[model samples]
Target chain A: MPFTSIRELLPKKDLVGFAILALIIIVLMPLFLDIFRLNLIGKYLTYAFVAVGLVLCWGYGGILSLGQGVFFGLGGYCMAMFLKLEASSPEATAIQSTPGIPDFMDWNQLTELPWFWEPFHSFTFTLFATIAVPVLFAFIIAYAMFKRRVGGVYFAIITQAIAAILTILIIGQQGYTGGVNGITDLRTLHGWDIRTDSAKYILYFISAFLLFACLFAAQYIRKSKLGRILVAMREREDRVRFSGYDVANFKIFIFCAAAAISAIGGAMFTLQVGFMSPSFVGIVPSIEMVIFAAVGGRLSILGAVYGTFVVNWAKTSFSESFPELWLFAMGALFIGVVMAFPNGLAGLYQSYIQPWLKTFINSMLSKYQQYIPAKFGLGKPAQEAAK
Target chain B: MTTTHNHKHKEMALYIEGLTVSFDGFKAVNDLSLYVEEQEIRVIIGPNGAGKTTVLDLICGRTKATSGSIKFKGKELTRLKEHEIVHAGVGRKFQNPSIYEDLTVFENLEISYPRGRNVWGALIFRRDDEVRKKVHEIAEMIFLGDKLDSPADLLSHGQKQWLEIGMLLIQDPELLMLDEPVAGMSVSERKQTAALLQRITKDRSVLVIEHDMQFVEDIADRVTVLHQGKVLSEGSMERVKSDPKVVEVYLGH
Candidate 1:
């Protein structure tokens, strides 16, 4: 029933868009690229999760959160903790001062695991915590800022500050958190070696599957009445409030949902990249995630996914050749997108490419219409097609 | 004072007393007391800066009252949030049209249909037959039935005003407060709006703030003249227009 409802909610054009994106990511990319490049693409797709969330939260809901990395980091760290625990089996860490505890803790002279780390020993708990912890943290931040009506730039700055703070805290608490190096040397998930090439391939599919799930969830929210309300609130908040909606609650929900989605991406990142670091949890990465959404067309969910690919692909290629100039290039790209094409790649496609493509297809179909039998009715006549 | 005694026998839809709102030591609405009876269309007329719009703002919870109580359907409203006030059966239309410009006229009215207002509810809310019917009904009422699918930004100035009113009407609030409903409307639009107001006010009380005396005379059941956030005069249009103090303070200009 929900699937049917979602089908009804998504228009035909959007379904086509989704299908094309799925084909490219799931089939073409894996088949064409080697395992190394496929792994890289998988890592990039993880960022698409954050971009998709931004499409709903910022584009639809008019919230500009600049600290999505914090949620992503939290999720990654949660999964990393579990993986670290699995790897730190008494036999594996027998040489360490404490055989059962993580190496970072032993290195810091800790005799036992922290209370928080103890639960990570259970895969089920760790799996739940990856999404739940980020959502809980997001809820708290959203409730505090939204309830006080602290929004727009202030909200963005506050979120950025939180990203900075979380990075510092993790770096400072080296003993418990793996510190600036982040939780590294994760080898297995429940006795299965995750470092193998086949493991990377499997993880890539899993990440792609999860990204689709999040995308569908976002699409559902975007088509629901809640989605319209978010747009309404963005245009005129007082009008929406006067219509009897508790505006703050909706904002909080979207923000928390965005956090959960970003966290999932973070978990995938940890799985695919084999490490969760402070570098990914800081303001820089959070802003970079926003750039992914912006360049894709902040308003287009599919655009965000493509945007993530384009920017990250550019980053990898550009930095490999001119590592020193990559930052300047990224800055130029953002400014160019904002100034020339505020709607990003999606808008450009919609305004220019889509219409022309439709016309070209229609003309081609009509040109061949006479060749086909009228009984078969393969294509409509030109006049009807125009209508 | 005499008008208060006269309306005291009737059921009160909205009773606001001692409503005061000060911003940085300037009282926008000062110690204002007003009563609106059931099914009454009360028009508030005053010069610019006479606190007419401020009165609507105070009752609708947009501006919190420093010292006062607003009773709507015998329920205290001063402590309620803006949306809570709306849910409590009090609707307010801004001085300028406040419809969502990006949405269609149908969407604007559908959003104000008074169901699935919470986050989870809105997520699961289906645009069922009843919602569609109500939306169409309200759109027709505001004379935007044909333009239901058109984006609100495409509407003319007068149509936008009507769209905002249609948004408020769908909520079916018992006390509908409109600020300058006819402001920027054409002569024909004003007449249509007056007639529209007369039709919708059949089951609910209306509180309107307007400057056009002609529009006021067409719809006002009782006129309240405000000056410096205080009631300068209160009576029928004829009596208030003739009042010496009202003439000296407001109409004389």
Candidate 2:
């Protein structure tokens, strides 16, 4: 009787319905947005990818890996490198209305592309590089840290340092790496006309689908025993180990997956936005990733995507709409959500909609039963008996 | 193999031959050899520096043996990782309360619920009616059938300990190792825990490290006194209690 009743309170089936609803909303977004609006939404969805990765590593795994932006930048730079290379051939360069190097890189006196920049001229290689680069970086770092048993604030410090160092290194290498300006002047991907409305719409839809994929995969993992193990590792690594699980392997797995997700987001982002900069890999963006996951609700995957969308929407709408007062609005929003809705939008849904719908449905069912008796002329007899 | 284990019992469930565990340069557990038999509740009593916890560490694979072999059920346990040791039927509970506090009592059990000990199978584990029935059956055995709906943190110290033991039991390890199981408990609670341990050892071996002599005397099938990283004396509770060395070491007589 204990679990029999307790099990009924669980939301497993209702959660599926919500996921289906989310998918429908995502699939139909392009129907409403124009090319320009779709491009903007695609950019937002790309950032949602970074948020999804953050939720996996920092939220679920208890690894505050601030260097996700380093992987993000790595992936973005790899894609930007390809786009820039494709833009820079003498025949290709002559066809561009503006110089491929831009006026600034040309002023830096760079005539040819760097050696590492050569192979990325092909789209296939850049796409491969995007996922591979982050996975490789995550593998090395997680192997060293988790194996050595370095945890707590030490993990945070080390990952943050990686991002800080990457940003500085990129900035210091001005010409080949583009320094602070960061290898811009990207015009197209795979020689396609990026300015075309249909092409841009297709990109937005691709981003939406990919976001759904990442979100679904993340939710599946969380619902699975792996998520529980990762949470167990976060709370007590020694206990999970004592329970007969390799805690480090779980950490490395989630960390690498997160890095790969961030990398994909970065690649998608640079392609859609036409720029990559050292600022993208800096400490601020790294902090923003954690804040989004925390403020959104780290436990839920939808919370991660939703958090990213809300934070970014605030940044886009309020910041752009208000300009100078954007930072204050964002701060207020963070404080408000953390104080009022500690579990993020997911908490809001649980508190407001879940019980209400249940009760409403129960009422409707009873009314239907009452109406059926009347339809058969049984209601009058029943009412008279009750009186 | 220059090392020779000098213990009399050859049929020991746990046999440590020349086991040495050191952190940095200091040896926490010296080249110490010990043996534990099946279904015996062996209480390891020791002073602050006696390395009682460290011995548990070396046995459970939390701390590596510098140059030694740890054998469990006649299998060399030195190369096995922590999870592998547990899979090999060695369960360890830490000195601290390590139960998942945020999750419900049932959820804590569900998280620790056994399903063939493979990641793939565990990942795909859904609500199998049989597994649920078995879990509830185990819950009833530990007297936690009524408390399953409560969050883990809401349980009393004794209940939490029982819940942790229950979590280990569903996996059904052959050897259950606990560090300070009754470190904090009332008289009735300690008695209840003692009864639970007695019930458990019917099918599994228990190694408990406790500072409370009364709690140890109530449950320990045998007592092994550790002094400065070595076994000072080990025998039946009455035998160890009356030994001159134990009196001298513990009571300063």
Candidate 3:
């Protein structure tokens, strides 16, 4: 039964998509690109985590959360706190009055380690907190809103407000949170120096590995009965409710799951980029993350990764030359994508490329039929020729 | 008015008293009391805005009653959530066909199968033989057995209506409420649906709100007619149809 379900989850087409993505991320990208470029791609891949979550929450579940950056920021901060503490060992901070505490806290004035920062000293706790903190926060927000039946545009606006408020709060509490600059200069992970090129390569691989793990998990969920329920709830909330499923509970669960995934991405971002900041947790970045999912084909999980890559690649190249026009270009791109191809790149592929590819492959196989052995399942042509 | 006794309460599948729901001071369902017997098929018929649908909404927990108690199989449903009401063995079909158009016909039924309703349960819910068999059974009953893989959006309006009925059937609720099950159906489709309802409602209590008097008379064991959010007449179909007040407000138009 499990084997059948596994097969069902990864059918031929989806398996091919997964394989192609794997080839690009694990084998091709690392082989071709220099470490610097690879590291940049790795950073973009972190955002793909959030996009993947959005695929489930927004694309399939019909939830459009504009506050994902808050979860990402929380996850990043959790990891950063641990890294920041390791970097701020008493011996390293002997120059400051508060030798054991973080530099920002020391700079703020005389102080011991705050209550929240103390647990982060344990790497195990930090790892758990990275996913848990964001999920818990998401649960609170989802519970409050969904219970009251707040959704659609109102939900989106509320999530955007949360992103804004969280950013402001982080920025306002500069002393404890590292303020507008965010927790910075993260030097090591568990006594190993992270600044070396080798570390960057290793971190990139780790991020890729985690991304695939997330992809598989998302794929599994997408195939599950719950996935259909999400779709059902999306189309008709009342119908699902009358079907004896708590619609709000499903919404809350998916929202929290999305948050946990985004938080994972945020933690990876901090590790790869060596900083955690309010800049990534604000409304703009949150909306940008949504664009990543949208352009990828909100309906497609694999599309989310490709979407993140394409959009980020464009942003990098375009912003380098015309930094002022990048935002306008992004706005235009979003509008054009929505107006022309509402499903994004994935939808375009499904509608046009996939069929073309199928026919092309069939024709090529037929052309090469004589050369192939009968044993290779191209036997149909060989048998026809024999007849 | 029937006096409430313990033995009588035990036989009742649904019992509503003083049910009133007001939207901005305009009472949609005003001080209405209704009782549905176990295995009885009760139909509510009225003109537009007579609040036939509102009664179903209140019982199904879609609309909060301004003042009332709805007891489903001895459980109070007015204070319950929609899903909670469903869990207590009440299923509701909306005015329009509300099946998930994005999914397959098989998927629509599978979702309505009574199992793994919670978050973790749904995540780990497997499409084992039991689910598959039940879905196939319901599909066959709905006459979509051959079209199980077909997307629901492609189903005709009548088929969509049956698919929604099939969805509710899979739940096997003790009390099923359908609003205008054959509103847009063709005459033959309406007859087929009436037959479908008769077969499916053997053991369960059905409270249906329908406009077509023929369909209602074909299936309804008893009919309740409403006027201005109040019950105008209640009895067998012939008795309710012959009532002067019921004819004056409803059939006379």
Q: Candidate 2 lDDT, tens digit per residue, A275-295?
A: 899888988788777667766
Docking class of 3: medium
TM-score (C-alpha) between model 2 and the true structure = 0.83
**Which residues of candidate 3, in runs, are more than 4 Å off?**
A1-5, A369-387, B1-10
Error of 3 at A195 (Å): 0.5
Higher DockQ: candidate 2 or 3? 3
TM-score of each: 0.97, 0.83, 0.95
List the candidate numbers ranked by TM-score, top first: 1, 3, 2
Going through the candidates in order, what is the number of backbone clashes in each?
0, 1, 1
Q: What is the C-alpha lDDT of each candidate?
A: 0.91, 0.77, 0.91
Worst 10 residues of 1 chain A by lDDT: A1-10
DockQ of 3: 0.68
The DockQ-derived docking category for candidate 2 is acceptable
The list of candidate 1 runs beyond 4 A from truth reads A1-7, A368-384, B1-9
Model 2 — interface RMS deviation?
A: 4.8
Error of 2 at A369 (Å): 6.4
Chain B TM-score of candidate number 3: 0.95
Q: Pick by DockQ: which candidate is best?
A: 1
Say which candidate scores most in TM-score. 1
